[model samples]
Target chain A: MSMERAIGFVVGIVAAAVLALIARKIVARRGGATGEYDERQQVVRGRAFTLAYAVIMVYLAVWMVLRNVELPFFNHPSSVLVGILLSVTVFVGYSVFNDAYFRTSDRPGTYIALIGAVGLLNLILGIRHWVRETTLEGRLLDNANLMVAAMMIAVMACVVIKLALDRRSEAN
Target chain B: MKNLKLKSARAGRDMSQQQLADAVGVSRQTINAIEKGDYNPTIRLCLAICKALGKTLDELFWPEEP
Candidate 1:
């Protein structure tokens, strides 16, 4: 790989690590002690992870077959990212419905706000990249911000629906 | 079968599901699932719930012989 690309990759990794640490700090502050999943939630989350792993395996298998067929689709890295996003969506959706996504001390509102903000930010960046593009050459999928925005939106929707269902159940 | 015994014990203490869950260090949904028979908690959680509700494990979790 080129030195510039290697440097960019290293920078990306470092930025992601810093962002993760910041997120952990925020969660710790909001929920006290980094927020622990209860036993039942831990069990449910484990099952969700298993299901997501299965999804990723299936997705990769399909991707491999498509590659052999020379199908016109997202580029290799973008395709792999799509598979990852799909699995993450499955995990998040299942966890939300199973009441395992949030910990006991977590306030769903805080997470909802955070997700909304991040999604909006990514959406803006994705839009800017789309505007600068001129051809249908898999450029859209290559925009990682768009993929992240889509994933965040899906996760937010799942959380909102779960919260609504919980409210209805409580009322009943 | 639903765990009506646990539900009753929690109610008897004038505790909401959330309150009992907080006291037992679990989520409200976990407590709800236990009451609805949707999730079977571990022994440690059972003990925690029993302690929180001031009930014995037999009273809250044991299935009565038909």
Candidate 2:
């Protein structure tokens, strides 16, 4: 790889790590020192993880088969990342529906706001990339921000729906 | 397979599902699931719920034979 590409990759990794730490701090401050899942939530989360792993394995198998079919979009480097994001979305959706996505101390409102903000930001960046694209080859497939935006927005929607269902059930 | 005994016990005390769940360190949904027979709690959780509701495990979780 070129020196500039290597440097950019390293910088991206550092930025991601720093952002993760900041997010953790913010969660700890808003919730508690640590979000504590009850035993039932823990069990549900374990099952969700297993299901997500199975999804990733299935996606990778399909991806391998498609890679040999001369599809330029499927052959993009971001395809693997797409598989990971798909699995993550599955996990999040499952956990949300099962009431295991948020800990007892977690304020779902805070998460909803945070996810909405992040999703909007990624959507803007992804739309910019899409609108300015000149090549038809892997234009959508190579845009990782769009995938991230979609995943985040989908997760947010699932959480919101679950919360609404829970509230209605509680009232009834 | 619903644990109506546990539900009645909790209601007899005028405690909401959320209150009992907080006392037992579980989510309200967990308590709801237990009462609805949607999910079975482990023995440890059963014990915790029993303690929180001031009832014995047999009173709350023991299945009644037909």
Candidate 3:
């Protein structure tokens, strides 16, 4: 297909992979031998996820309806990608909102902000793609790919550094 | 947010979040949140915190002195 769409697909895949790694770590940490996630945390997470799922489904329905309508600036793939990004973002938002409200925790806000930033970045990328009908091999898509890759690497690096520091302190 | 004298005392004793959580039978995240003033401990948890830090309730959670 178009270069922009191809770039979006690649970015989406990379984002999915990064999110998977983060989720795996969260699950492992939560299920570790020592002081794992309590029943209350699980209950809160379950409720939040349920609400997220509902919001995602509703977003999908709305997206489908909007796709049929002739929108001037919005196209098929961009709209679809935006819908998917927003769906996942809604989940992240739900998690942070629930954590802040019910658990009185502030840590989840960081995760929420990160997700929101990524969503906004993707939305910008989508709009840029629509304007510059470039091929995946073109400069625009290549730059976008590089930017996303850099962000993923940065996130992974930060996590690794934090874990290393934690371990080092524990040993001392 | 109220100051966490218990956490401050525990830290003064060179105890980590995990150590304090273990002593109080709670998660490390809970200890971290409490120390950061992002959580309000229950009465039972407050007692546990006081016990862990080797302090009385009044010392750890004093009223606003006039």
By TM-score: ranked, best first: 1, 2, 3
Candidate 2 residue pairs in clash (backbone atoms < 3 Å): none
TM-score pick, better of 1 and 3: 1
Cα lDDT of model 1 by residue, B1-66, tens digit: 799999989889999998998898888899999999999999999998888888898999999899
lDDT of 1: 0.89
Judge the docking of candidate 1 as incorrect, acceptable, medium or high: high
In terms of docking quality, how is candidate 3 classified?
A: incorrect
Runs in model 1 with CA error above 4 Å?
Answer: none
User: For residues A1-172, could you state the per-residue lDDT of candidate 3 as single tens digits?
Assistant: 9999899879978998998687546534544322345333555467767776777688778766765785532334444444454554455444433332223222333443454456466557755754676665343333443344334344434444554665686799
Which runs of model 3 end up more than 4 angstroms from their true locations?
A1-35, A38-65, A68-172
Best by DockQ: 1
Model 2 per-residue lDDT tens digits across residues B1-66: 788999999999999999998898888899998999989899999999888888998898888888
All models, DockQ values?
Answer: 0.93, 0.77, 0.09
Question: Compared with the true structure, what per-residue lDDT tens digits does model 2 show for residues A38-71?
Answer: 8889899999999999999999999999999967
Model 1 C-alpha lDDT per residue in residues A51-169, reported as the tens digit of each score: 99999999999999888887667335788989999999999999999999988877888888879988998999988888888876545766888999999999999999999998898
lDDT of each: 0.89, 0.89, 0.58
What interface RMSD do all candidates show, one decimal each? 0.5, 0.7, 6.3
